[model samples]
Target: MIDFLPMTREDMVERGWDQLDFLFISGDAYVDHPSFGPAIICRLLEKYGHKVGIIAQPDWRSTSDFKQLGKPRLGVLVSAGNLDSMLNKYTAAKKYRSTDNYSPGGQAGLRPERATLVYCNRIREVWKDVPLIIGGIEASLRRFAHYDYWSDSVRRSILIDSRADLLIYGMGEKQIKDLSTQLSTGMCIRNIRDIPGTCYRTESLEHLWDYIEIPSYQNVAKNKQEFANAFKIQYLEQDPIRGKTIVQNHGEQYVVQNPPAMPLTTGEMDEIYDLPYQRTYHPVYEAAGGVPAIQEVKFSIVSHRGCYGSCSFCALYAHQGRIIQSRSKESILREAGQLVKLPDFKGYIHDVGGPTANFRQPACEQQANRGTCRGKQCLFPSACKNLNTNHSEYLELLRAVRQIPGIKKVFVRSGLRYDYLLAAGDREFLRELCEHHVSGQLKVAPEHVSQKVTQLMGKAGKETYLKFKKAYEQTNRDLGKEQYLVPYFMSSHPGAGLKEAVELAEFLRDTGYHPEQVQDFIPTPGSLSTCMYYTGINPLTNEKVYVAKTPHDKQLQRALLQYRNPKNYDLVYEALIKTGRRDLIGYEQHCLIRPPQTKQLSSRQPRPEKTDKPGKQRRLTPTRNKTAKKQAR
Candidate 1:
């Protein structure tokens, strides 16, 4: 059972509740996914015997929820993850004719949205002394100094904005555990500086500490306006092992130091993966029916942490680190066994992946360092030099899962690293994958088409994706069955604008798989890419780029990903004409307004399918696979 920290100070007084195990003020509606930060932290707190309550959709517009979720007996955890907030525009841009243009769930701002700080400020209004602990993508991404795209200016550190006592970045399991245990014992917040994975401002106390190394990507010390200029940090947590400044909280006088990044060791990784979890999939659709469990499969198993394919937009590398760490095989399998025994026992496991699912322990274990990562994510722009690209251990792990009694099928639903899949000594392994693994679809994130875009994302060559595609096709044919690589991509990223997005659209249009759902880039405050989005330059490379920042241009840029969706037609047309984006107009109109070639033929001959279906499908294949072949060519 969880409590929603209610609104009103008297109500807090009314509850008259004494000390609590833990207090949780959340940005999410409490969907329990381990990778979904708040849930993991809450569950972990419970594991530590801390009673926790939450404030879902903490409508800053209304302060009622505050009265109920009073100050913590132990401390407070503020996470706006799952259903979290960022620097998304609280107001809508120009409304499209169709309501389909609304920004996805969390991006368009709170229904009566306010910034996290606003929410935190509202809470402090009721209980100012409550120890506030903050983490989650929203907070973590903005933990350091960052450029606020919506405000068109630099912003101060998230600690200043949210008014939290301490900000815990990354996956936060271990760090949070330590924070909770330490605070419960009456350790002052200022004393938490020495703890690993924590960032806090401290009062100068006779410099009572050893070399307190700060991180290179540590929170930027800038005022709100100058803050936007602070968007250079990349990995939110330690992706490898590195750091920046150790300021004395009393005065500005501080020791600016960067520690060698500490990567997660294999044993530490195991503790994370082995945490108890309920993997049963709760279908959102089924809840409406009162049937309880949805028809979808739930494969509740834990994961070893760390992912190396650090996509610029992803926060996993920051939280989990890039090094692969796993719990004992017995521990993972044990969880698998528990899921199989659930009421609607299934013979399959839905997924067993993280970051880039198949990535395993560092390829070469002989390196001087085992885990070396700074919270600034590395998996996004590139694999770490110390990354274990080897898939042998992973293959064995998957193989072992299949041997579980009830697991008739164990699929790799997590997207695969296609580039890594194509490496030498790995093709045979990949070939073996198609032969043995794979349920129906193997998700792959060839995030974009343009080499320029892929380069920006630290992805492998377009050739790598193409080779994987060809090999996959070849493998499927050899196995004599049809399977697919469901590719995942994003729209409106920092490096993408109308031309790039359209080029991607054209690629998709030619390939015949125009995505209907696309991710509009949300310039989360702390991401390196967010810095580039606001500053028009890659901080890492210090290179300038043309950014699509206006509302109208952003809409068109986002719409390009789903050019075939009828709902996007109106907006795309307006976007194209206004932005001088004629190149994308034809495809936009053709897909959204005009009928397809098949539709034209069908109109002429109602029964053409009986006689011309074969040829027609052949004609469609080129267009369908054209995007697919772009890399091959």
Candidate 2:
């Protein structure tokens, strides 16, 4: 019988345990699903014969909650849930988000801002000297001194601020297991610093060998150039196979980061995902309507991990790495079988992919031994000659899952790399995807259509997206399905000024696309785009880039994307005027918006006489009575 990991002391007592080997502190509600990182790590630790318990979204206001589980015999693991705490609590506009999906009842403010630091500080007040470790997205990306958008200043590495003994960076299955083994052997947490995929602070450099030292914290904090240079080195050396040890000085102490943990093999990936995950939030959250985040992944399956898409704004390159690690077909099928047996299976498999769904294998054969090619992207600018754009294995897995009994439809809701799909020259996958997987609409992230913007975003050119769009529409038509393509667009990304935003608006106008939601680029820590947003220079190329920094500037760019929305008329009008593109504000068919004077004039026009006969109604001219035309429709 599979059950959630012990959350309260009574849970441990029920299992005939008086103490825990490790107590995990999370910034999210207890959801023991594979999609949640804390659950995976806790379950893996349990499998290793070490007693583990979790305290999810503990009250950081006092040490009483931190003391509920008492101190673990080994250490305490801290994570800011699946997402960065700040990102989860705030939107791009730095406004407080109304709800947190990871929290029970979809309520917000359960977790404090800078949650890892806050939780760790509370733990210190309670236990004083308990082994403290921090990981997950928050600590992983902030393993070095970098910019913090919220504070609008450079903050030190999370290790230094949180005062953690060790910081585990990537997908931490290997690092956590290794750290557990060493600790089980009675090694002190401070001495267990040689593990890969982990970071530690040290005052002495004598013990460290074969490492590249980037700019110091003081240097990066004050100098934008040094900041970009440091990020450049970190970005290039993120691979597991060929990456070297990276060290950065923070005043008197130094933070050293080991090469990332190797990508999981097929069997290893299987074992991790196959672990006894209850596949939902704990029963304690039942009263609060359960953790809202579980709805998306409850009936879904993760077929792979990691991505090589290398979108500048994406943090997958820094966290999951560029190498792709996919589970075997049998493993995915087994999970799908479990989903079928679920009490609320609903006969639909929501998703069967990860980070970038279509990426099942590495970009090239050389990645097996050499790691991802440094300073080069597989799908940016254009598909590399060495790229492996195969979809046979993934297509086969999808087909197999669909064959499972009790399954009605298996959809690929995760992101699809259309460029890779088109490059493969395989129409069969597209046809099958259109005929079966699409659930009325398929979402793709084109981000932007302007050549300058797309180039800066490290996405494929506009031509590629146009080709894919054409192919997708045609495939759906041939399948006799009316499925639509929902393309996601971003605004105010670095290099996107009024000129570029207008270009994107024109593209949307031309394509007859009115996106309901527009993503305004947020400069989160550790992504290449964040570096660009901060330094006004592309870290990779050291070229100056335009950044829409002011709140008004960002609003204008965002409004331009949704120009058709009546709520955005003022911003759109101002943007068009500012860009000297007032030509776009006229009543032309290609215009993004109608001029204010024209709208006023049309509103002032008299209403036409009511017609009793359907075909005998007077037709309104194109120029006059625009309001009457709207009312007639």
Candidate 3:
């Protein structure tokens, strides 16, 4: 019978286990789904015949909660859930988010900031000598001494702060398996530091070879140029095949990172997804309305992992790597069959995609043998001549999934790399996507339209997006469908200024597309864009970049995206004037917003005469009342 791993002392008793081999502490609620990273790791460990138990969202205030699972026989694993704790708890504005979907009932404040550090410290207090290991998105991205957006400073590697015995980075199935074997064989954690995809602290680097050392923490923290230089080295050497060990010094101790683990083979990927997963949050959370985060992935299938689309603002390069690892169609179909048997089956399979939905194989044949090219991207600026842009395999997989029994419709909700899709020149896939898959609307990310901004973001420019838009519209017309394209746009990236913001607003105006939501770039750890944000220079190209650092400056850039919204009128108007583009504020058909003079005149003439009847006053229209409310504010 498939059941959740032991979560409490009672659960341990029920399993007839006196001790767990590893105790997994997570900041997220106990979710047994494969989509959750903690679940995957824990379930994989259990599959290896090691007993594992979880302590999810433990009270970090004291050692009381940390001691609930007693102490593990071998080690304790810690993770800050699926997301970095700081990013999950706070918004780009550095304010507390009202809700955390990973928590029960969507409550906030269940986990502390820098949750990995806090949880590790608590574990130390409870079991001073227990081996401690940290992994997950929070630990993986912040493994090196890098910039922290929340603190607005360069902080030391999480290994140093959390005092973790070891740090595992990336999708760490391989690393965990190797580490567990060594530990089970009676090897000390400190001496077993040569495993790939793991980072460890050392007093000296005497034993390490074929490694390159970047600038020390002291130098990078004080000098921006040194910081950029260090990041450039780290970014280039992230591949598994060609990458070398990277070491950085922090005072007397040094942090050494082993080369990344090889990407999972198709058979390995199938084994991982085929693990017996309960596929939902633990029953303990049912009373609290369960975890809100699971709803998005409960029915959706993850067909693959990794992406070749190296967008600068994304950290996938560091975490998932550039190599594309996919599951076999047979594996995916089996998962779909399981979903169809669920009691909540609604006939609709929410999604059947991954990081970039249509990417089902490596970018090119050589990537499998030689890894990705360093300091180069497969899809950016332009698709490389060697890039394989075929969609036949992915198209066939989607077709096979749709033919699954009891499956009515399978939507592709994940963002598709439109540039890659177009490069494939597969009109059949496009036609089939429009004819069968899309759920009335398909969302794509063209991040920005300005040529300079798009280049900085490592995304396609306006011309490419426009071409795709035309093709999509024509395809829909051919299918006699009224499908729409919802394009996602970002604001206030490292190189974007008021000028680029206004250019984007103009594009939106011309297309008659008013986006309901605008994404403001957040410079999270481990991304090249974050390096640019902290140091006013692109690490890869040492060129000076414009950064909108102040709150008001960022506000103006975001406002320009939704210029039609009356609430953003003031900031949009200010941005237009600041950029010397006041011409866009007129009453012309091409104008984005009306002149302040016109707006003022209209608001002032909105009051009507009082009614003669007692207690009867004329009600104002929503537009007039909204204007009045803005004026009062």
Clashes of each: 58, 0, 0
lDDT of 2: 0.89
Clashes of 1: 58
CA lDDT, candidate 3, residue 70: 87
Candidates arranged by lDDT, highest first: 3, 2, 1
lDDT of 3 by residue, 249-363 (tens): 9999999999999999999999999999988888888898999999999999999999889899999989999999999999999999999999998988989899999988899
lDDT of each: 0.57, 0.89, 0.90
Show the lowest summed lDDT stretch of 10 residues, model 1. 605-614
Candidate 2 local lDDT, 1-633, one digit each (tens): 127788888888889889999999999998989999998999999999999999989888888888888789999999999999999999998999999999999999999999999999999988878899999999999999989999999999999999999999988999999999999999999999889899998998898788899999999999999999999999999999999999999998999999999998989999999999888889998999998999999998998889999999999998999999989999999999998988988999999999999999989999999999989999987899999988998899999999999999999999999999999999999999998899988889999988888898999877888999899888977878877787899999999999999998888767767666789999999999999999999999999999999999999999998776677778989999999997887656677777685554333322222321111224457765665456434
lDDT of 1 by residue, 178-277 (tens): 7888887899875666556666754443644444433222333333212233333333324334344333221342322122235555665555545554
Q: What is the lDDT of residue 508 in candidate 1?
A: 62
Every model: Cα RMSD to truth: 7.8, 4.5, 5.6
lDDT of 2 at 43: 90
What candidate 3 gets wrong by more than 4 Å, as runs, is 600-633
Stretch of 10 with least lDDT, candidate 2: 606-615
